[model samples]
Target: VEVRPNPGGKGFVTALGGKWGWSGSGRAFVPQLVMYAGPADYHNKPKKIDADIETYLVGHGFNGFHTIVCCRWFDINEERSTRIKGPAPNPDPRTFEALELLIGKVHSAGGMVHIWAWGDESRRQTPVRLGGKNGLADLRLQRYIAARLGPIPGWTMGYGYDLDEWVARKDLDIWHRHMHAQLGWPHLLGGRSVGPNRYRRGAKFPQIYEGLDYSGYEQHQPTYEAYVAALAARPKRPSFSEDRFRVRKPSPYPKKDYTEELTRRGLWHSTMAGGVANIWGKYVRRGQKTTFQPYDHPEWIKTNALFFKGRFVKDMIRDNQITDGVCLRRPTGEHFVFYKEGAESIRMDLSKMPGSRRAVAVDALKPYREIDLGELRPENQTWKAPQKSDWAVAVGEFRK
Candidate 1:
C-alpha cells in the first residue's frame, strides 16, 4: 500500500535538493504564522509589514506562514450556492498586491512564504486557471507565472490542505504508462520500457514550473508515500516529499488536553516530519466556530519539545530517535498493538494495561492480526517485544 513520509522524523534539506529524514531533533523551531490578519493590518498604511515579518523571522523563530486567509482567491463558481456568489468577473489587485508585499517582506526577513491555497474546482479562483487543454494549459500558465516571478530560492511552494481536490484529477496510471513508454525505462525497474529516448526520472512539475512544488497532505502517511514513489518511478521527477500539515485531533478529539496526543503523533514513528507542527482554524464550521484561539505558550511548547527530544535523540535524549522505538499498545488502549514501524525486535510490556483478550503476533501487527513470518525482513529482528517494560508496571501477555 502507498504511504506518506513521516513528517515527525527530524531531517534537513539536503545537498541533493531532497529532504533526508532521520531520528533527531530539528533546530528550526516552527511556529504558526496564521495569515488571519487582513492586508491593511500588515501594510504600511496601518502597520509596517516588513518590520512585522522580520520580528517573527528573527525574533520569534517562526519561519513559515500557514495560509493567506480571506485573500479573495476562492471566488471560483461564485454563482453556485456552495461558493461565494455571482460571477467573479475580475481579479482584485488590491488583495493580490497586498499578498505580494507580504511575501516580499517575509523573503526580505529571511523567511519562507507559501500560498495558503483556498481555491476549489467549484470555486475556480485559482491563480493558474484551468482550460481547454484538459487543465494542462492551466498548469502551464501557473508554470509561466512562476517563471516570471523567478525562484523564491528558500521559500517552500506548498498549497493549502485539500490537495486531493487538486491532483486527483490527473490520471496517474495513464501518465505513468505514456511516460514510461517514452522513456524506455528498464523492465527491471518494475514499469515497462517502450521507447528509445528512454531515461529514468523524466521531466516533471518542479522542473517545468516551480509553483506548488510541495504538497501539504493533512492526513495519514500511506497515500503521500504512494504518490511520491509513483512520481519518482516515472521518467524523471524532482525530489518531492509530501508534508502532513494537518490532521484530525490525534485522540479525545477537540478535548483541549489532546496535547499529549500531539506529542504521541508528532513524535511517533507515524509522523515523517518534526514534532513541532501547526494546523489552522478549527476542524470544521458547525461544531467549533472559527475563534481566534492563539496556541502561544512556552510550557506546552517545551513539553512538546521535550517529548520531541526524547523521540528524536536516542543517546543524548531518552529515546534513540523521536519517531523510533516501540509502542506496544495503541495509546487509545485498543486491541492489537505492536511496533508498527515494520521493526521486528521491539521491547514492550503489555501486562499492566487492562485487557479483555490478548494475542501478540510473532512477526508483526497486521490489519487482521496476521503477519507473514517468511516475508519478514531480516534486519528488523534486533528488538523483541519485551516481557516487561522496565519503567512501567507489568501487564499480562499472550502470544498468538
Candidate 2:
C-alpha cells in the first residue's frame, strides 16, 4: 500500500518519495491514486477535453511508484463515440497519448493500473456506446483497452456497473472469461452503490457474487460479517470494500478520531473473510472536498502498516487459514480467532475447531508482542486483550 509522511504537507503536492509499504512478505497492496477521467463535473463538458493527467500525477505521485492506480471512465467514449463506434475502431490519438503518458508515470511510480469503466451508474451519465447498451459496449471497451494497454504486464480492467443492472447482464460469464483468458488479467467484475436504499428497494446484490471473480461496493450491510457471509457463499470470489474515507470532522488539520479504528476493524474483517485473494480495502475521503489525504490521520496508515507488516497476519490472510465470519466456519480441528475490542478480553468458541491449543492476545498497534493464554481446550476460552485500546487477539496453536 502507498503512504506519505505524517501531516502530508500543505498543498496537493508531497515529496515524491517516502515510506511506502510495510517491510514484510505478503503485505497488502494499496492504490497510489484513483484517477477520474473525463470532465470533473457529473456531465460532459464539450470543451473540457481529456483528463488533467499532468495535475493528477503532480499531486499524487511518490518515488515513481504508485502500487495501484484506478482510472474512472466517464466521457471519452461519448465524446469520441461518432468516429469510434466500432469496437475495434482505431485508438484515439488524443486519448491514447494522454493514457500512455499517465500510465508511464504510474509505471515509474511502481504501480499497477485499474480502469473503472463505469457501467450504468448514477455517477456517470454516459454509458459505454460500443454495443448500444446491448452489453456489447463492455466487450468493445475491454478490447480497446486490451489492444492499447494489454501488453503492459501490471494492469487490470473492471466496471462500476450498478447492482441491479449488473445482475441482469447475461454476458457476465462470457465477459469474465474473455478478460481472464484473452487479456490474462484478473477481472474484478462487480458494482458499487450497495447503500441501504438499494437493499430496501427489494434488491439483493450480494447473491450475484457467485458469478464475479472479485466483488466491490462502498455501502453494503451494516457489519463486516454480513458482507463476509455473502462473499463466503462463493469461497472462490473475493470482496473489495471501498469504505468511504473515515474522517472525524471537517478540518484541514489531521484529526485522531477519523474512524481509523473502525476502518481497521473492517480491513481485518475483510482480511479474514476473503484471505489475500478476496480482500482489497480502500479508504476514501467523503464530503465535497476532492483531495484525498487519509495518511494525515495517524492510525489510518499505522493500523494498515502493522497489519500488513506482521508475517503471521500476511500468511493467515494469504493461505485462507482464517475462518471467522458468517456462512464460513472455522477450520475444523484447528482455528484462529482474531477480534478487536475495548474490553480486557473476549470469549472464543472453539467448538468446531478442535485440537486447539491456546489464545495469544496480539497488539494491533504494535503487533509484535504476544500474551500467552496458557493451555486451552476446544471450548470457550477467555482471551485477554493485549493492549488497553485498539487491541486484537489471536486464538490458535502457536508457541504457547
Candidate 3:
C-alpha cells in the first residue's frame, strides 16, 4: 500500500488514508520486533509460524512487525563469504519464498512489516566487498529485491541495521535514486542510523534524506529525553525508534536490564514524544524456538491497548509545557496526558481551556486498573495517584 507522510508532517498515512497515526487499515501501526529463524523455519513449520504471528497480532495489540530480511541474522546464502567471481549474486529464491510467506501472513492478519534488508554485519553483501568497482553489482542486487518484494502491500524497507557505520553517502544517494525508480510501488524507504558513539562525527545523517519517506534512530538504551530529542530533530517525516534497550532473558548484560517497568516507560515516553512507531526488541537465543507470547508482559499489553485503541490518541501532540512532567495534549487543550516517573501527583495547567473535564489516574505498575478522580475543572489542577510509583494521568474525555 502507498504510505506517505501525514498532512501534519509528523506521522504517516497509507493509501486507505484517514488522518495521521493510523495505518492503511485505520489502526495505529505500533511495531514489535520479530526475529526470523531462517527460511527453514518457514518451510518446515508453516503452521506453527502462522500461529505465532497470529498471537502477536491478535493476542498482543501490535499491528506491525519489524523484521530483518538478509545477512548475518538470516542465513540466506553463502554468497557474501564466497565472493563469487561473476556478476552480482542473484537474489536467493529461498529467501524470497520465506519472505513471501511471512509477508502474506502479516498482511492477512492486518499488520504491517518493516523489512531490514541487512544487519550490522552486512558490509560484505554490499559493493564494499563484492568488487562492484562501478557499483553495478550492488545496484543489481537491490533491483532484484525491489522487483520481488516491491509489489507487496503493508510493508516498508530499510537499507540495514547500522547504516551510518559502513554505507557511503554516494552509495546511499545512488541507491535511493535507483530504488525509488525501480520499485513502482510506494513502499517507504530509509535506513537505520547507527547506534550512538560508533563514529566520532556522531550520526550526521540528515533528518530528511532526499528520497526517503521516513527517518529512523537506533539506540541500545535510549532515555525519555533522548526519544523526545530524536523526534524533535526529525520533524519533517515520520520517525521510528528501530531499536531500544531489548527485553531479553538470560541477562545479555551483567544486570537484569529488561524490566517490565523499563519497557512500559519506554513505550509511553516514545509515544508521548510524537514517535510514529517504535519496536520492542526481543533477543532470542540460537536454536531456541520462537514463542510469540503476549502475556509475558501484561503491562505492555495494557499500555498498547490504552494508547493505540484509546480515544484521544488520534489528536494528542507532545506538550511538555502543560505540566512539570512529560505530557501530551490536543491542540485545542480539551484533553491532556501527564506522565510522571515515581511521582504521586501531577499538576496540569488547564486554565486557558476553561471547562469541566474528567480525569483518570493510571498507575504505571497496574495500568489495567485506573483510579477515577471524578470531575475536574479547567483551572490549574493537581491529581494525586493512589501510590507514589510511576504514574500517568488522562484528563478530559478518556476511554474507561
Weakest ten-residue segment in model 3 by summed lDDT: 10-19
lDDT per model vs. reference? 0.32, 0.41, 0.61
TM-score of decoy 2: 0.56
Best by TM-score: 3
- What tens-digit string does per-residue lDDT give for candidate 1 at 1-400? 7756646443321111122122122333333333334444444442566555544444333444544432253232131224443323233345445556666656555444444433343454343232321245323333332443232222333332333444432332333233234432111001111111112243222211122122222322222233333234331212322232222343333332234224223323222222122432212223633222323332322232222222221111112221244332333332223333435345443333354333333321111122222222212233344332211111123221
Q: Model 2, residue 117: displacement in angstroms? A: 1.0
The global Cα lDDT (0 to 1) of model 2 is 0.41
What does each candidate score in C-alpha RMSD?
A: 15.6, 11.0, 5.3
Order of candidate numbers by lDDT, starting with the best: 3, 2, 1
Where model 3 places Cα greater than 4 Å from the true spot, the runs are 1-36, 43-46, 71-80, 83-87, 121-127, 131-134, 195-211, 249-257, 284-295, 311-315, 398-400
The lDDT leader among the candidates is 3
- Pairwise TM-score winner, candidates 1 and 2: 2
Overlapping backbone residue pairs in candidate 1 total 38
Clashes within 3 Å, all models in order: 38, 10, 0
